[model samples]
Target chain A: MTPTDLRAAFIADLTAVAPDLDPAAIGDNDHMQDDLGLDSMDFLNLVSALHKRFGLPIPEADYPRLATAALAVAYLDQALAE
Target chain B: MSIFTMPSLGADMEEGKLVEWLVKPGDDVKKGDIVAVVETQKGAIEIEIFEAGQIGALLAEPGQTLPVGAPLARLGVADEAEVTDPVAAPEPAIQASRAAALPAPAPAPAAKPVAAAAPGDAVLASPAARARAAELGIALEAVTGSGPGGAVLLSDIENHVSAGPQPAAQPVAEDRPKGKPGLDMTEMRRAIAAAMSRSKREIPHYYLMHEIDLQSAHDRLTALNADRTPDRRLLMGAFLLHATVKSLAKVPELNGRYDVEPYAPSGQVHCGMAVAMRGGGLIAPAILEAQSKDPDEIMAAMRDLVARTRSGRLRNSEITRGTITISALGENGVDALIGVIYPPQVALVGFGAPRVRPMVHDGTIQPRLAVTVSLAADHRVSDGRRGALFLTEIDRLLQEPAIP
Candidate 1:
């Protein structure tokens, strides 16, 4: 898939995990915990979902970057760019 | 000469009875070889010698509970006698090998709970707690021992168990919730209170009090409770239980408890009993597989349940989830009062006021010992048609002369 497509897919997965947020509202700047009400377990589940969807290894150290929806999009964009 | 203090073993070991002496006076002693057997912590352990020397003095008396390390035996210097000691070379190597084999319990750096305890202030808790503390790999000194003389309690270990490196299930707050919002019974009860208020409020439940016609079931029950004692007896409650079991067997549909949560058909026959505790609140414990057990066995199980519930030993798994209930107030002057149908359990059968009441048998007024049986049925799953049928079956089982 194209980088943009993969990033959009990543955004779609995040929105599915956090269904309260409208798909249009989620972006790089939106934080999962504070902005989307995703707790630690939900955050871990999000990482697991991302790993399954993209087939990439996500280390615990990368948790900070994935905290925000914008950072998640960027990280997914970079991994797909690779 | 090393001043070897007694190694603090279990918390309960304030002092130990010297069980046996492995080495005699003037016997050459090795470091690892058990010099003596000290009975501490309600069990015996082989006390190893620290120094390779001559067994010069026997300080502790056998069968006397001496404080650990009260100088049971002394070792003289090698030059004092012609000591041909073969065990000396392996002692240092054995010490090193023991250190290498065992995981070193390095206490957290710069963190000590308090000053080391004196002999009088040492732990004396149960042996199990000491072994548990050891298994947690906790430093005894770091733990604020909470037993007698500041020794630790079992709860203290549990409370402090997760403070160190926890491998898994660390209450991530989001994963395993301690609790959730209480179920709001407003809407559900409004409809229930309406029906129940209407049932008691409207449907005139004609009073029909019957006595415990216990002629045939008694002989079998008497034979059952009678035997070489395991200490359980089949009383009137057991008779009631047997009757209820028989009643459920006669009417399979009556066995169902109210289950509206899943909105699926509930297919269980759990009988709930109302136990009046010393305190004010009332709780009904459900008996599963009531039909399968005989009167004696049912009474035995019921006694255990009563004892467990009264002593606060009943597990949450016991009562938190059940299929049905048989809440009774037979001793409490209640003659089959109207019972509230507890949610999810389809029926709550309350037994009450077991006494003699005059009844007309073939135009002859005769006084017969009768008991009031109240059944509260979930209206959503069943109506008065099925409810009456269920009650008739229960009445039949209680009054029947024979049950196979």
Candidate 2:
């Protein structure tokens, strides 16, 4: 998927876990925990949904790399490419 | 016919407002069928019937706040054929008579005085049926139940609607207490006060705290989820619940209710998870038979239980049947929780957020993600030594990769 598509999918996944979250308001560089108010459980659920949808395994070591939407898109794009 | 009364969901609950009925008269029902939604301090609990039979009649009106054991509906033995293969049968004359008598030319007498006089009279009605009846402004006494044993159900409400609106006898909101917002903190606080005060007063509680190293379990979880997607991932809480159940097996004295003559030990682990509501107050409902479940199943059950609990849709079994309790404060929560033992229950276990702490592993100092596990057991049933052993078992279980 394209970078834009990847970001959209991530927002959709985030919205599913946290129903109160607004997809349109989320910025590309917004930190998930700081900006989106996602706690550890919510973050784990979001990652789980993303991995299930994309057929990818988000390793614990790369969790820091995917802290923000732009970073997550970039990391996923690279992983998908290889 | 058997009168199914309002069940006591918990020791604290004295009365429940019949929120809605799922069945109408004459519908066939079985044991374990969710028949009604009763609003208690905890939330909207779906009450299940213990007896399998046909619905006879709905005695309690929707919106009626009744005490525990007050008859909600009547249940009767299902026909031999219907029990084996349930199908739509013709409505009985008594039901037809009630349906034909419209707007009750005059206010009618109480519908089930004869049934009420005898404890054995069965009335069958689902919670959905009663709720819909109240919403549509139809009198349940007027609708003929077509369910087995003349029980009223949702279809009967629809049938009444098809028959056209009858003049409502009671104002929708009259007699019933004014409808309040879903989360009423004042009422919740009162309920919590009663329960906590009772716990503190009755049970002789002995407390113990143990620090558990989660580094190995954390690394193991990460490795297990390494090849799996997020959906398939297991949280640290799942491991904790599994370990708690296993430890209880080794120290059985710390499990079960302490209210009766002799403190009874529940052979199975029905672990109560103390969840704080977003609005206010707390509820610790159980995930029945936690010991029998695997980590993945426990994770799924925990997720579903938390969701349903927060959404105010807990089942009766989840609320009433817990033998032991677990309270966990997440990453954002405190370092330790010394909780009061929820009464009837002999033990309450708590877990604080996992934080980096200086630890001596293999005689060397290193940073590890460690959490404090605390137990509050009833002194009448157990002492601190047993509590310590249980905590030790939990710590040991987390270190192993295979938790079965």
lDDT of 2 at B252: 96
Q: Which whole-number lDDT from 0 to 100 does residue B239 have in model 1?
A: 72
Ten-residue region with minimum lDDT total, candidate 2 chain B: B80-89
The clash tally of candidate 2 reads 42
* lDDT for each residue of candidate 1 in B147-263, tens digit (9 for 90 to 100): 787676666667667575322112212232111111112322333354345445433333322344443354554455454222433455667766766665544554553333444
Roughly what TM-score does model 2 have, to 2 decimal places? Answer: 0.74
Chain B only: TM-score of model 1: 0.45
**CAPRI quality level assigned to candidate 2 from its DockQ score:** acceptable
RMSD of 2: 10.6
**Per-candidate RMSD, Å:** 28.8, 10.6
Candidate 2: DockQ? 0.40
Q: Each candidate: what lDDT?
A: 0.52, 0.76
